[model samples]
Target: MTSRPAAPVPATAPAVPAAGRLAAGEQPVLPLSGELELRPWRLDDADAGALLAAGQDPDISHWNLFTVGSRAEARDRIARMHRRRTAGTGAVWAVAPRGGAAIGLAALNDVDPADGSAEVAYWVLPAARGGGIAVLAARRLGRWALDELGLRRLTLRHSTANPASCRVAEKAGYTYEGSLRDALAHADGRHDVHLHTLVAG
Candidate 1:
């Protein structure tokens, strides 16, 4: 008697590799419109000055929860930024004119290369505000993160009270997903956050 045919084995879904998408390397200077660029933070006084200024600016301090009381602290923060890149956990860039001191910052925080996702964040100095620098920098960084780095999703979250950031997120082509209740804590108190996202095409 012929033996009964064996049942077919069910195919299993392919597993995602545990390797990280980002590896330690020389971070490239990403170009923005006409002389503006995003470069890695340097351990120089000028870059530290930018961080100090941001920490001191009332709006930036309030929104970003950043406070650098001294130049040394700012330098230490810059060093940490580099270390984050090396660790594949974050990528921070100084937004500036070619060969000039940074006037703003753009960052990919909480980067999970295995998951292909990261959060986008930025802040422009008072002098740089009102010129659409934040929008430009955000757009350029999003492109780099999605197109160049192969991240599947980029999230941008801001306190619900920050209309300017909402505008920036919109202009940068991020789609608003919804609000997150008590998602972020600020100097004032806990705040609800608006979540926006950009996905790779």
Candidate 2:
């Protein structure tokens, strides 16, 4: 038998989602209560003083996973967040209360539209922690993700040492899904993590 040439392959094609289904695109700024707004981050938001202070506060330091060193670095983070939002993989919202500075932050990440899932995280200034704002922000974001973004599940992960986050999850209606033993890498060593989840109805 004679040998035959193979057919040429096509160039890399764009990702094709299943018919009638598609990845969630960029999420727009979502609003919550009259006082609290979940809004897109502005460069000026970083200059509000609270953003840099939260990065330095022990209670909220976990956000500085790589240790942002200066106000400029923090401002750079806001810029990065802007890009992330446009990319549709995440969002960083300034938790601004009416007539006040942006005193906290909330966000969604690891957005997987194929899996209909995403991860939620947040922080409040030490001075902003007691008003149940974290819980409210988490709930607002979670609802919007499940209802508007078409996500089926949302997860919340935190170190076991951070009991405050656990309370926030509970108040936000996330069920405790047990711990991932020593799964979190920390500056001091490995730490056990609590995993929580909220499934859409």
For model 1, what is the error of residue 47's alpha carbon versus the real structure, in angstroms, after optimal superposition? 6.4
- Model 2 spans with C-alpha error above 4 angstroms: 1-27, 62-66
What local distance difference test score does each model get? 0.88, 0.78
Residues 1-201 of candidate 1: C-alpha lDDT, one tens digit per residue: 999999999996333223344544689899999899999889884444888888899999999998887888988888898888877888899998999899999999998866778999999999989989999999999999888887889999999999999999999999999999999998999999999999988
Q: What is the lDDT of residue 40 in candidate 2?
A: 74
Q: What TM-score number comes out for model 2?
A: 0.82
TM-score of 1: 0.89
- Candidate that would win on TM-score: 1
Error in Å for residue 52 of model 2: 1.1
Clashing pairs in 1: none
TM-score for all models, in order of appearance: 0.89, 0.82
Off-target runs (Cα >4 Å) in candidate 1 are 1-21, 45-48
**Candidate 2, RMSD to the unseen true structure:** 7.9
